[model samples]
Target: MSDKRADSVAFVRETFIPEQPAPSTATGAVKWLQDNLFPTWANGLLTIVSLYVIYLIVTATTPWLVNGLWNTESLAACREVLDGATGACFSVLTERWNQLLFGFKYPPDQYWRPTLAFVLMFVALAPVLFFDLPRKLLIVTGLFPFVSYWLIWGGTIFTPVVALLGFVAGYFVYARFVKGSFAAGFFGGVAAAIVVWLIGGGFIPEGANDTALLQAVPSRDLGGFMLNMMLGITCVSLSVPLGIALALGRQSNLPLIKGMCVVFIEFIRGVPLITLLFVANVMLAYFFPPGSGVDLFLRVVIMITMFSAAYIAEVIRGGLAALPKGQYEAADSLGLDYPQAMRLIILPQALKISIPGIVNIAVGLFKDTTLVSIISLFDIIGMIRGPILASTDWNGVYWELFMFASVLFFVVCYGISQYSQWLERRLATDHR
Candidate 1:
């Protein structure tokens, strides 16, 4: 057969031609540029117009940024240096950098405390954010809230110690009761915590803060970016678990639980967050026992946590709803109880599905922390609009100061967004 075919063929090459490289337009940068930027006439025109607009923006802003005066003592000094030139007075950021970061009222000498806490935040978060890290590192994650609170608030060590004790007691109570009934465990845990706190409160000696190693810093003294970060982290941490509970309750078979969850979520979600902040600032105090003064910061935290949790519950509910009914049937077939099914089978998938929405709420909540300034809490924005801008030296440095704030927010929000995308990719189970 081979001989017949060879004879029938007119001619055959003894050797094949060497392989040739593809054309530039069909590969590499040129191909990418064509496919992405200029796939058609309309797209090419849009790309050209977009490039022109970008060029105009760059030309308009470059000189101002390039000529920025960083070393000057004041906006006036910066202007003097620039001599009526198109330049940014970045001296405001340079001069009040401490105030922008740690707040005007934060003790300069004790700045290391918050700074240390901030640095340690990464260590605590590392295990949770990157699960490949040693699981034992989660002990640090568990202790961070108490440790950070002590560092930043700087009260009697007994305060955090007692708080930790209360939680420990609550955990033991919950563990003891949970085997029989979840409700008993939950309410018993809460009651145990309250009892521990009440008993511990009496044990803390009066003026313990005065004799403490680190000086007490009142919540009123918390300001600037530190305050914003603290609020963002605290509210997000508290809200997520609360949100998960609410989401589950909303779907429960029990009418009382479902109705209450529905009412709470709807009421909180329908009202503007600003209104809640106002309530936290003013009306919330009235609810506390007469002269049993709750800290303004705590009130605000409660409000913010409640606000964020409602939105997150809705997001998680959507995720729960998205799951196939077959998943639930599979859980039943395995003879898993409701809690076991949710924990071991359902929640992990729902949470993965909810990641994007959860991250969105987190980012938005972080940014919304700036609203605390309106209640006189003096977050970073509050510092700018209050002290920094009002100061005689930096009065007119609007663009530079606001630009710095914008950059800080952008970096944080962008990081959250990127992490969410990474998490989504990592958790993706389906084949395209």
Candidate 2:
């Protein structure tokens, strides 16, 4: 009985002690530090280097952000604040905010038009970026010009009337006859648009002489950032379907069709954009009848569209090539015609796969719209340049204006890139 009692006591002692938790080879903050910061000689060195770099950045940035003289109200105040030491003149940005946001030439009463258009653009773009918007809603959203024109140029009914005709004609052609084949739909819409324009007497505004209707409202050079957007959108919207056709042609079995596509793509790609723009400006008039005169802005739009389409064709060709051979073979096996197979199966998949790449190209094209400033168009950057040079009170404001514009562009491009990433991920899942 005593022996049994001793064994019971031993069992209790062993169970209660719990083996001292096996000494826990790594635990607490010390272990974490050792693992992360000093796991090896290389890791320890990297940790020390990273800390030093961070210290340098903080020491440099803290002074500039908080105690710099450039944050002062004026150059004189800046000099007094920092005792003539160096720093960024961020105050200049706040001082000329109005001129930068709205050109000094713009009337204050009309500022509301641009402001409202800006807000609407953001609202329209938000759903396009973040949500899986219905196709119908997308079509409506794309008609921003109609709403914006009513707000901006309230006195002129021509803009909204044209927009309505375009929307109606596009819907009729695509929804009814063409059944959403982009090539057929686009051509059909164009034909219908011409008919609408003729029937609605668009070429003859009521009570207006031919000369008055033909007169330019504003100089091509006076067009602002909004004008740049309009040009880009108009050009790209026209070119996309054309680009797809070129891509398909380049991939065609017919030698003549493929050769034509190849020549067109190569010829456009080989030339500089500036040369093309110059041609549009100087030589496009010769192409039309002797008495006919083309609008300069329209000419520029045409050239840019053609140039952009060539690049888009190459991008889409890459997408087409990436598609599996089995897809083409299966379509053939199902007795589908080339156009039917491509429209129903291949193109949908290919376009979905190419979304991210296409968005990247679009962002590039958007940024390149600034190049219009070189042709004397007063895009935002051009307007800013004039003010910086002209304003005696705001001399040397280049950095401030440029930085602000850069930030705006970065935000827009970054948003587009992020949206593309999301679309790619969503499409990847759908394919699976």
Candidate 3:
């Protein structure tokens, strides 16, 4: 009995009790380094190299960030202290921040106009980003431009009122009669836009009587970051839909239409955007009749739209191709016509798939708007360049100005990337 009890106790202890911890030297930080950093010969070599690189970066960066001579109060002070040494000049950034945010030409008292426009733009765009917004209210978002123009320009109310009426009438005619197809809606919208332009441009003799109002807001006075934003947004918004149509046309069964689309896309994609801008700036006049001079701003916008559209078409084509043939077959089996299949079934899925790619392209286009500097447009980057080169007080401020601009671009691009990621996650869930 005693022997049996002793045996049972031994078995119970062996089964229930935990083993003692391993030796300290073979675990914790040392074990982690062994397993992760030096798991193999190659890994050990890589680990050592990476650590050395990190050490070099840290040593190089610490002094510049914490103790560098870049923190002077003025340009002269900075030059005096640094004396041919290389470091960032952050003081210039502090002094010229206002000019960077709002162009140098913008009057200090009238800075409110751009600020207000910027705020309104964000408000109008909010609904687009947040899916919880009522879709029906999107019409108001589309009208935001007219509202913003009136607010910024402080024009006679009659002009904006007339434009708004024409727009509403156009929307109704297009939606009810034109049936929302691209061709009908486009032509109808164009007709409405023409009417608005006539009213704004004072084609009517009575409308022309508002000379004081027209004189109050001159075309030359309208060049700045606000102009850049307007041009970029309008061009992109118009181009994206056109691009969708072009992409679909390229993929269509009709040989003539497909061939034309292919030629256009290939031709535009082959040329550099700078060449297109130069053509708009120089060659567009030759295309028009002798006395009909197009606005430089309008020409630039046209060029940007065409360039962006071609690229967008390619991206959308990729999305369309990625879709399974089964999807097309399924749509046909459901008795839906080609247009119905595309609009209701195919495009939504395809566009969702291409959202991230499209946003990336958009960010690139936004950054490229800086190229307007080449054509004498006073965009933010262009404005910075002038002051950096011309100003006695701000000369040699390239590092500060470039750093600030980089941060601005980074923030905008990063936000766009994050939003795209969120959209991707949401769409993934919907697909599942």
For every model shown, what is its TM-score relative to the native structure?
A: 0.95, 0.75, 0.79
Superposition TM-score, candidate 2 onto the true structure: 0.75
lDDT of each residue in 130-149, candidate 2, tens digit only: 66666566665767767765
TM-score ranking, high to low: 1, 3, 2
Best by lDDT: 1
Q: Which of 1 and 2 is ahead in TM-score?
A: 1
Least accurate 10 contiguous residues by lDDT in model 3 = 212-221
Tell me the tens digit of each residue's lDDT in model 1 across 1-432.
Answer: 999998998876899999999998899999999999999999999999999999999999999999988898987788778888999988788889999999999999999999999999999999999999999999999899999999999978998888889989998998888665454466588789889988898899998998998999999999999998999999999899889878988897778878999999999999999999999999999987788678999999999999999999999999999889999999999998776788888899899989989999999999999999999999899999999888898887788888899999999999989988988888893425
Pairs of colliding residues, candidate 1: none
Off by over 4 Å in 1: 1-14, 179-188, 429-432
Specify the highest-TM-score model's number: 1
For every model shown, the clashing-pair count is 0, 0, 0
lDDT of each: 0.90, 0.71, 0.74
**Better structure of 2 and 3 per TM-score:** 3
